[model samples]
Structures are given as C-alpha cells and as structure tokens.
Target: MYTELNSILNTTPDSFTQGEFILVSDRQSDASFLMHHFLSFYLRARCKVCFLGLVQSFSHYNAVGQRLGVSLVQAKEKGQLIFFEGLKESLSVLISQESNTKSQAIDFLRDPSVGLRSLYEFVRCTVSSSSGGGEKGADGAEEWGPPVLLVDDLSVLLSLGVTVGTVLDFSHYCRATVCSQLQGNMVMLTRCDGEEEADDGDDEGSERLHRGLTHQCSLTLHVQGLPTGYCRDIHGQVEVCWRRRQGDGQHTQKKLFQYKVHDKGASFFARGTSSAVL
Candidate 1:
C-alpha cells in the first residue's frame, strides 16, 4: 500500500474499522487504479475480500496486483479472496443461446424482473462463509478480519437494464449483509457528471444511484480529471467527503488532493504541489 493514501484517510491496517460503506466515484478519468489500491490494501490487512469484477477479468487485475506486491492468485488459493467474474460469466451466457430458459446470477440479461438476487446471494455466501483454516489470533482462534465487498462499478447494473431502485436495493441488501449482519465493509465504484451541476446528457439513473449511495455511504471519494485536460505530473484529483451522524443530525467533512499514478502505486499530494501546475 500507498502510505500517502493511508495518511489522507487516516486509516491503516491496524486502525481501520468495520461496518463502513465507502463509495468511490469517478467523473471523466478512469479510477480502476483506486480499486487496485483498495484490493491490495485490504488483502494486506488480511480482510476477507469479495470482489465483484463486473468490468474486467481476473487476469487483468492479477497483473496490476503483482506490482502492488501482492499475488491475487495465491490469495485465491488461500481462500482470502473470493472473486465473482461477472464480465466473463455474463459474456458466456450471452453466447450460449440458453439464456431465457433459466435464472442465473445475471438474470438481468434474461429478464429484468429477475433482478440481482443471485448475485447478492453469491456475495453473501462467500463473505459469511465459516470454512476453517486461516490465520489465528493471540488466543489461537481462527480470525478472518471483517469481510469487505468491493464492486468495480455500479453503472454496469444500470446498463444491464436494472432500474435505479433495483441497483440501490442490490447495494442496500449487500450493505445489510456485509455491514450490518457481518460488521464488514462495502466499497463501490460509480460515476456522475463532472460539471458543477448535473448535465442533461448525464445518465439520470446513474446520478440517482450516485446520490443514493452518497447518502448511504460513510465516505465518498470523487476522482476527477484535471480541468486543463492532460497533465504530465498529475493524473487527476481526488475529493474526499466524509459523512457522520450524531443523534439526529448529519455532518460532513471534505478535502481535495492532486495525485499521480505510477506503475507500482499512486501518489497523492496536496493541491498546487504538482510540477505541472508550477
């Protein structure tokens, strides 16, 4: 992991808590690098991670992962990681010519009415698993750190013909299971309009989903491209928004940082610090 990120979030493997909902939002720039950061970050923390890779294959992630100093292949073998290759599975179902006949994990393609129940079930089962064998604690009791559910992007669900409510409910149920029941965490990646205001061309359903998640999530990280277009020194900027509830009131805290993505990892620096701006 990137200590720079850990400093900004004020979180470390030992200090991180459970029952959190982290929403990673991207406007124009690709934020898959953030996903890689979290995937490796959690793995290093020894948390049971269930990755719903809907946009890319496992091999793609494994390749980026090797540079982060973690072997996803080994993690899968050790049962520390559970992956749901939605991209590959959905493609196979599309080509098989046997879609409309049965209810599968991606029932959205076959019939929108089927919803994402099977997909949620897959996540619930994997994270709640009680299978033996893992690192033990001081008491010698098997310890699997709080489970984490990571979704690469939620817009795909909308693209798949799932309604806004359906996508929200899918995340809601996942939150209920991973955060409430299991005291784990949920990290979702989504997108929205980068303009100061919502754009007419923006996907309304997606915006609704983003709004819904922003309200539900404890933290919102908005990653956006630079205003001047391309920057040799800075890849993009990250806006961190934290939401907290006390008694009957809700409060929020926000921060912004410029960042550069390198091969091994990404670096986060305060605004106006990049050489490109100077």
Candidate 2:
C-alpha cells in the first residue's frame, strides 16, 4: 500500500474505515493505480476481498498485485480472495454446481434485459460467507477480517447492454449488503465522459452513473488528466472529496493533489511540488 495515499485517505493498517462506499472516477486519464492501491490496502488489512474485475484477466491483476508485494495467486490459494474475471464469465455461461457467483454473473450475456441480480448475488454470497457465526480458521479464529467488495470498473456492465438504472440498482444493493448489513467496505471505479466525449453525447450514461455514485459514496477520488497536459514526471491530478451527513445537511471537504505512478508505488504531491515543476 502507498503510505502517502493512506495518509491522505486517513486509512491505516491498524484501523480501517468500514461501512463506507468509496467511488473512484476517471475523466481523462488512467486511474487503475488507485484501484491497485485499494486492492493491496484492503488485503494488507486482512479483509476478505471479492474482486469483480470486468476489464482484465486474473493474470493481469496478479502481475500488478505481485509488484505491490501482495500475491493474488497466494491470496486466492488461501481462500482470501474470490476474483470474477469478466472475460471468462462472458465466454462461459453454463450453470455450475459449484460457486453460484460465477454461473449467475453472466446472465447479461444470455439476455441483456435479465438485469444484474445474479451478479449482485455473487457478491452478497462471497462477502457474507463468514461475517456471521459462520466459518472459522483451524485455530478457531475468524478466517478473515472485514469483508470488502472491489469492482475495478462498474461502467462495463452498462456497455454490455445493462441499463443505467439496473447498474445503479446493483450498486445500491451491493452497498447495502456490504456497508450496511455486514459493516464492511466497498470500492468501485467508473469512467466519466471527457469534454469531447460529452460534446459528442456518446457516454452520457456513464456520466450519469458517475454522478449518481458520487452522491451515494462517502468518499470520491476523481482522477483527471493534468490541465497543463502531459509531463514525464507527472501523470494526472486527483480531486479527493469526503462527504458526511450532519443532521439535515451534508458537509463536503475537497482537496486536489497531483500524482505520479512508479514501479514500487505512486506518490501524491501538492499542486506543483513534483519534479516536473522543479
């Protein structure tokens, strides 16, 4: 995990922010690093993670996980992580006697209008496995920490012919199950339409979804390409906003930081403190 990012996010290995929804939205740059950050952060926190990786394969994420010093292969082998690979799921739709999460997840491929209930069921089943007086370890302790559900990107469900309302509904149910019912955490990534894409009116649905999630999420990390354009030392900028309900009113605090990704981890800097500025 990134120490600088953890400080900015107020998340530490000893204590975690549970029962909260974190939304990661990307406008004009790659925000996959943020996804990696959380994946490792939660794993290091010992949370049982259900990863719905819609855009990449297991190996792809495993490679990145290795670089971050968290081995996805080992995690899965030890039954700590359950990964849903969209490519494999979409290709194989046969119902299995095994895990219902996979068999039900590709319902959209069979019928576009079937909705994402099956997919949501997968997540609910995975995270709720041992939260109650359920499973235990060999030493008679709880097998894992708090449950966590991480979706690399939620917009791909829309591109696959699911309605915006359906996707939002899925998110709502997942949020309720993870955050409210189980007292766990959820992290979801979505792409927003850029200026040109917005002008062309192509990805308005994604924009709506992003806005909808932003309102529901407790924290939003919106990543955008630098206004000054590309620089070798800087990748993009991130706007971090935290929201809380205070009686009848809501309070929001926002901050912007520039970040650069390196082989080990990423660094977040003040507005102009990166090497590019120096």
Candidate 3:
C-alpha cells in the first residue's frame, strides 16, 4: 500500500514502523503538496488519521485528497479519519463581534493561547476516543491501529502570537504522549526559512523551535524547491534523515530524491533519474 513511499525510503517489508515524530520542512506551497502525498499514503494504508489543518481550509484538503485518489469522506465514515478545523476556528474568533470588552480586532491580535489550548484539548480528546471502540469498527472487535497525527504548518501558530517555548513544550508533550501512550506516529509540517523572515526576537524563537524539534524528532524530511524557471520537468527535491534513540544514537545516512506533481499524485524518484512527465 505504501509502495511508493517505501521505495523512496529503500525499506523492505515490515521495516517501516510507527511511533515516532516525523518533521517535513519546505516552502509553504511545496510543503502542502508533499503533505498530501504523505497523508494519502497513510490513509490508504488503513491507518487512522487526525489532520489538524492550520494553513489551508478543509475544502482545499478535501479537493487535494480527491485528486490523490483518497476518499476523505469514506475515511471519516469508517471512523478512520478526523479533522480539527484550525483555520475555521481562527476565522470565527477573529470575525466575532458580540458583546465583548474593548475591541474584537484587538482581542484577536493579542495571543493565540486560547486557540492553542483548544487545539491541544481537541487532540487529547481525539486520541482518547480512538483508543477504545469509541468509534465504530469494521468487525465486532475494535479497529485499533497506530494512528497518524498530521499537523499542517506549525508556523501558523507562531505567526498568531504563540510563544516559542509554548510551541516547543506542546510538541514535546504530544510526541511523548502519542508515541508512548497511544503508540502512534506524529507528523508536523513547518516552513524551512521561517527564521530568516522574522524579526530579531522572532528569529531567535524560530531558530530555537527548529533546533529543539530537530533534536526531539526521530526523523526529518527536508524539501528544497527547485530554482525558478530552471526545471520545468521536476517539482522539488527531498532529503530524509533519521536516527535511532535506543542504539548508539548515531544518525543514518541521508537519502535524497526528487518528486514530480501530477494530476493523480506526487511521484518520487532518484535525484538524477528521468521519469516520463505525467
């Protein structure tokens, strides 16, 4: 089921295991495309997926899933897919004009603590519910597999005034909790050049967040966008690096690949190999 992705990782059957944090870094647009590939792979593999979308609307994701041949509606109906509407929640809070204190606009601009807390709570609830037979299953037994938690663009929280420390703590907590308790895999997407585009304080915060998450995560995937107008046939490049915590703590050699986006989905290949354009 995950043949394409497994081929990119050069892994044999039963070699790919869940229960670790995987970080995907890229430009905003490219990151979104790569995320679709990852999510489609897991969903097709019959793993439960909880998608927390902060960068794009739910409709955008639904369209992308459809193009990838993933039936998001069916997944949800089968109790294998759940979505946390981060964008919708933020927009609702920002546009609300009911009886409040000072100004609704100013309140929206303050901090993202409220939103962050809500997100954390939602994740906790979803994880807890999926553990037992809280949701229906195919057979009489509970459909319990290692769930995949995907968060699109963690930088959105930072842009909404979430402190670096808070974000780091939240990430660590989620990774530990999900990997240890639920025995699931957690994937987070972030911008590669965030530190370069922010102010001094934000720059430092972004750098710290990057370093901390890099150390905490078991695997990291870096996506580099091709030079503008340089390669019409290629979409982008990726590097997958991983380390084992149980062994000597040594890192594995990085694997490189290039991908092409098509109507169906993204296809990965060796860096220099030529794939027929779809």
User: By lDDT, who's the top model here?
Assistant: 2
lDDT per model vs. reference = 0.84, 0.86, 0.70
Ordered from best to worst TM-score, the candidate numbers read 2, 1, 3
**TM-score winner:** 2
Q: Model 3, 250: alpha-carbon shift in Å?
A: 5.1
Question: Which ten contiguous residues of candidate 3 have the minimum total lDDT?
Answer: 101-110
- Better candidate by TM-score, 1 or 3: 1
Q: Kindly list the per-residue Cα lDDT of model 2 for residues 176-264, writing each as its tens digit.
A: 99999899999999987657344444545888898788878999999999998888898999999989845436579899999999998
lDDT of 1 by residue, 1-278 (tens): 78789889989987796789999998888888889889998999989899999999999999999999999999898778988888777876778776665336775676887888888888878888732234464556446688999999888888888888888889999999999988888899997755646546555677788888887898889999988788888999999988874543656888999999998888899899876666
lDDT score of residue 274 within candidate 1:
79
lDDT, candidate 2, at 22: 95
Which pairs, if any, clash in model 1? none
User: How well does each candidate superpose onto the true structure, as a TM-score?
Assistant: 0.89, 0.91, 0.81
TM-score of 3: 0.81
Predictions: Cα RMSD each:
3.7, 3.0, 4.8
State which candidate, 1 or 2, has the greater TM-score.
2
Stretches off by above 4 angstroms in model 2 are 94-102, 133-142, 196-204, 245-250
Clash count list over all predictions: 0, 0, 0
